[model samples]
Target: MPATAYDAKGLLKSAIRGDDPVIYYEHKRLYRWIKEDLPEEDFTVPIGRAAMRKEGSDITVVSYGLMYHRSLEAVSALEKEGISAELIDMRTLSPWDREIIFESVRKTSRVVLVQESSKTGGVMAEVSAAITEEMFDYLDAPVTRVCGLDVPAIPFAPPMEHFFLPNADKIARTVKKVLEY
Candidate 1:
């Protein structure tokens, strides 16, 4: 659910009212970082729906979890450079919203996927493959991914972990490269 502030309640509700087993990932780093005033009334954010975090015309950035936040930072930087980037928060990855992704890609003609997982066989791989298979003709540039290094595990040291994970600079650089292509 992108590990955002608004997702905690919805995730809890989904877990409580599950027809099947549901697995939820909570980012510990966001525990103190994200806070929001949610609606008092009961509600359930539908599963399998992605959220359009930002809209733009130049390029599309698809991401989930903490990477989604990082992508937004990159998008902000790109905006200052006159590169409008559409950011999509992939709330649910299992049954992701391909329609939204395709629509954005069609409009922008360029895409950059960001994720914290390893570059090898990560969620971005599946997403990039789907885009290539379904929307190759619509793309102006090859799909690019800003992902973690292909390592056995994330490093415990802050510096090493920073280097291992995808950050705003990496995302911004990749987006610029795609736009320039």
Candidate 2:
């Protein structure tokens, strides 16, 4: 999920009726930005499945939450530069969609994982590890991570917060670096 309001209700319903615990991380920044019309009937988006927002062949960009939107922006920029990027939204972070990720990497031969969490021990670390362990032979370049700085706490000021967080520019830069490698 891209942390949009469209799937919020479904995620909530899934959490309530799920057999095991579900940890949903709501992005505070998306609260005011994302709005959508949801279905009137009750629905649940299953956990552990990733949504492929865009299809491409050059590189694969895997992300979740706010970073997913940012990754799309970066993908758009890359598209302008003649680089096709496949964007995947890992809705469930705990049980990430390994099948989709492996397939994309196998086809594109390059990948970059974007996240807003701190770089140290962030979710991307596990994703990178998985790719290295399972898809090493498919990779043309090393897995790149576009993540927040290794800060103890997020900054309160807008400027500082922007600096600490991963944005489209940062993601695009990382994608370019990975492509060059």
Highest TM-score against the true fold, candidate: 1
**Residue 140 error, candidate 1, Å:** 0.7
RMSD of each: 1.1, 1.3
Model 1 superposed RMSD (Cα):
1.1
Tell me the TM-score of each prediction against the true structure: 0.96, 0.94
TM-score (C-alpha) between model 2 and the true structure: 0.94
Measured with C-alpha atoms, the lDDT of residue 13 in candidate 2 is 76
Error of 1 at 154 (Å): 1.6
What residue pairs are clashing in model 2? 1-91
* Candidate 2: residue 144 Cα off by (Å): 0.6
Q: What are the runs in model 1 whose C-alpha is more than 4 Å off?
A: none
Q: Which stretch of 10 consecutive residues in model 1 shows the poorest summed lDDT?
A: 1-10
Tens digits of per-residue lDDT for model 2, 37-104: 88888788777878888999999999999898899899999899999999999988878899999999
